[model samples]
Target: MNTNKTELNDQELSRYSRQILMPEIDYAGQLTLAQSHAVIFGLGGLGSPASLYLAAAGIGKLTLVDFDEVDDSNLQRQIVHREANIGQAKVASAKSNLAQLNRHIEIETIARHMDEKEVNELVRQADVVLDCTDNFASRFALNRACYAEKKPLISGAAIRWEGQLSTYDFRNEDSPCYQCLYPEDNGQELTCSQNGVLSPVVGMVGSMQAIEVVKALLKLPTLTGKLMIIDAYSMMIRTLNLKKDPGCKHCAR
Candidate 1:
C-alpha cells in the first residue's frame, strides 16, 4: 500500500494552523490548496491582492502573467511593485514580491500578452485561471482559453467604487462561462485608465477573487454558479445566479 502523503512540516503547520482549525478546510483542505497550481493574468489592481493571498495560502505553483512596467500611479493599487522597482517589468517585480512573502511556492512569469494558441497551452497546465486584466480584449481572450480548457475561472473587474466577481467552470453543466454573460466585446469603451478605480476597491475585490480560487481548487462549495456584485461605497454585496446564454457565441459551439 502506498500510504505516502504530502505532509507539511512543523514550520508549515505553524504557518497554516488557523486555516486548518476550520472544520471545512481542515488539514486535508489546506494540503489540497498548497498543492494546487493557478495562473493569474495582469498583475495589476485585482491581480495584486489575488496573487498575494494565493501565494500566502501556500499554493504550490503560481504563474504571474503580465507585460507592463511599474509606474508612479500604480502604487495605490499595484501592491506587488515597489517604487524602487519602477523601471522593471511587472512580472519580475511581482515575482520578487511573492518570493518575499512565501519562498515555498514556485513562480513563473511571462512578460507578454498571449493569443489563443499560447493561452490554451498555459490554461491546460493550470489548475485554475484568473482574469485580472484591465481591458476587455484580454478578458475575452482569457475567457475563451479557460472555457476551452475547462478550468475553473475566477475573474474580477473594478472601476470607480464598484467591483464584480464571477466564476466559470461549467462542471455542473449549466453555469455561464464568462462569454455566456458577456457575449460581445465592443471595441470603443471606457477602460480602467480612463474611468479610474479606487485603490482599496480593487484590493477588496481581488482578495475575494483569491478566496474563490481557493474554494475552486479544494472542490468546496462556492458561488461558481453566480456573479457577485459589490458596491464598495455602500459596503453592499449581491449575488445573482447566472445562466448559460444559449446564443452565447463563444460557448454555444
Candidate 2:
C-alpha cells in the first residue's frame, strides 16, 4: 500500500458517496482505500462476500487466490460463483463477478495452489491479507506469511451456525498472530462441508471481514488484538481479547 494520496474522480466520488459521508471515512479515508491493495486467499463462502464488499468499496487492487473449481454444491454458500460457473476455477469465477461489481478496480486471479514461498511473496505485495481459507493448514500458512511480511490479516470462519472473526495486524508490535490463538493444528479442523452451515452465517462473517479491511486501510481502530465470536443460533456476539504468545514460533522474536 502506497501512503501517497489518491484523488477520486467524479464518477468514483459518486459511486462511493455513501461511504465517504461517514465521518470516520471521509474523502481522505476513501482516498487511502483507493490506493490500497488486498490479497484474499480463498474464493468460497468467506472470500465471496469479502471480495465483493472490498471491490464495491473501491479498493484499488485485489488478488484472489484459490485452486478449487466451482461446484454445484458451492452455489449454496459461495455466492460469488453462479450456476454457470460450476466448472470454472473459483478464482476465475470470483474475478469475473468482482469485475462486474467494480470495473474501476484491478482484479488479479491466481487459480492454482500456492506454496509457502509464493504465499509470502504475495503477502509482501499486499497492504493487507484476508485469510478466508477453510482448513487449518491454509490458515497456519497464511499466518506465517503475514507475520513475516508484517501485514495485517483479517481471518474469518463459519460452520454450523457459529462464526468467528479476528484481525491479526502484524504491523502492530503487540498484535497477536493467528497461531497465538490456535497454537496447534490437531488435524481435527471442521468445515462447512462436514458440518452444516447456514448461508447467512458466512455472509455475516465475510461482511465483517470487509469492514475490518477498510478500517485497517484507513488506520482506524480494528479488531487487531481481539476476536469476535458469533453464535447465530443464540443471536449472541462476544469479544475476546487476544494476547501475543511470548513463546509462539510464528511471531516470537
Candidate 3:
C-alpha cells in the first residue's frame, strides 16, 4: 500500500463523506484540500459566502482579512452577519459563522487594513487569494500583491443586479490580471451602498468565488483566462475569453 495515499480518519471520513463520493474530488482531492490554505480579503457579501463554503469544504487554513464592522446595511447581502452581529468586527462574526459550519479547520482573522508588505506576505503564504473586496483601491492593491506573490487570485464583484467574476493565475505569464480587465483608477465606482443591490446578487457571485477557489486548490480547470458576467434580473450568464494585454502593467512579461 502506498503510504502517501490519502487516508481519512474516522472523523474526517464521516464529515466529508459526500465530498469523497464525488468523482472529481474523491479521496486524493479531499486530502489536497485538507492541506491547502486560502486567504480571503473581505468578509462582506462575497467573502461571507466564500468563507462559509470554503470552511465547509475543509480547507486546512483560512486567513480572513477585513477592516470593517458589521453594519445594519450589511445584513441585507452579507449573510454571515446577523442583526445581533451589527457593530461587531466582520472578521469575528465571519469566523463565528464559519466555525459553526466546520470546526476542524484553522481560522485566522485580521480586522485591520493591511499595507502592501502585509498583503504580499499573506498572499505568498496562501495557495489562493479571494478578492471579495468592494473598492477599486483594495482590489488593485490585492491584484498587485497576488501578482507579486505568484498566487492565483479569485476576483468577484457585485453591485445592483450585476456581478462579475474572474481568476488570474500569475503562474501563467499569458494570463491577464484584475488590472487588465479594468483600470486601476476607475472613477466614481458604484457601490452597494450607493446603488442598491438585490440581496441574492452578491450571494450568487460569492458562491461562484468559492467554487473557483475550490477548483484552484484542486488543480481543476477554472476561469483562469475567462471572465463571467451575470445579469441577475434577466438571468443571463455570459463567459468571455480574456486576453493578456501586451502593455498590461501588472502581469505582462
Candidate 4:
C-alpha cells in the first residue's frame, strides 16, 4: 500500500466516480481506499465477489492466497474463474481476473498454502484480512495470525442456504477474536461440497464482506464485534452481539 500517493489520477477519479459521489465516501474516502491493502485467504465462493468488488472499488493492493485448483464443480459459485482456468491454481486465476477489472491496482498471488509464520507476516502487511477459507483448520490458523498482528479480520461463511459474516477488529482491546466465537472446533465440519449451498447465498455474504472491508479501510463504522446471520432460504437476516471471551486462548489476556 503506497500511502505516499495521496492523489487519484484522472482515470481513477472517473473510474470510481460513482462511489466517490456518496456523501460518506466522497473524494477522501476513495483516495483512502486507493492506498489500502487487503489479503483474501480463499478464491472460492465468498472470495469471488469480495475480491471483485474490492478491485473494482479501487483497493490499492490485494494479496490472494489459495492452494487449491479450480475444478469444474467450482464453476457454479466461484464467479472469478472461467472454464479455461479450471486446472489453474485459484489464487492465480483470481489474480488474473481481478487484474482485468482494475489495471491500476496491484494483485499478488500466493498459489501455495502457508504455515503460521508466513500467515502472520502476511497479516502484518495487510490493512485488513478476509477469511474465506472453508475448513476449521484454516479459519483457526488465520484467526490466530490476525489476532497476533492486530489486523482487522472480516470472516464469511455459507452452506446449505445459510451464511454468516463477522468482523474481528483486533486493533480494539475489547473486540472479540474468532476464537471467542468458536471456542471448540469439532472434528466434523460441514462443507458446501457435502451439504450443498445456494449460489446466491455465498454471493450475498461475500458482497457484504466487501462492504465491511471498504468501511474498515475508510475508518467508518463497521460490523466489528457483531455477527450477521443470513437465512437466505427464508429471506431473513439477524444480527447477534459478540462478546470477547475472557478465557479465549487466542485473544484473552
Instruction: Give per-model CA RMSD.
Output: 2.4, 1.3, 2.6, 1.0
Error of model 3, residue 158, in angstroms: 0.5
**Candidate 2 at 206: error in angstroms?**
0.3
The whole-model lDDT of each prediction reads 0.86, 0.92, 0.89, 0.92
Which whole-number lDDT from 0 to 100 does residue 82 have in model 1?
92
Candidate 3 local lDDT, 131-162, one digit each (tens): 99989999999999989888999999998899
Q: Over all chains combined, what TM-score does candidate 2 have?
A: 0.97
Kindly list the per-residue Cα lDDT of model 2 for residues 1-253, writing each as its tens digit.
Answer: 7555458999999999999999999998888898999999999999999999999999999999999999998988899889998899999999999999998898998988888899999999999999999989999999999888889999999999999999999889999988888876555788788889999999999999999999999889999889999999999999999889898877886
Top TM-score: which candidate number?
4
Clash-forming residue pairs, model 4: none
Better of 2 and 4 by lDDT: 4
1 or 3, which is superior by lDDT? 3
Clashes of each: 0, 0, 0, 0
lDDT over C-alpha atoms for residue 115 of model 2: 86
Q: In model 2, what lDDT does residue 194 have?
A: 81
What does the lDDT come to for candidate 2? 0.92
lDDT of 4 by residue, 1-253 (tens): 6688889999999999999999899999999899999999999999999999999999999999999999999999999999999999999889999988999899999988798999999999999999999999999999889888889899999999999999998888899988898875555789998999998899999999999999988888888889999999889999999999899877886
lDDT, residue 136, model 4? 91
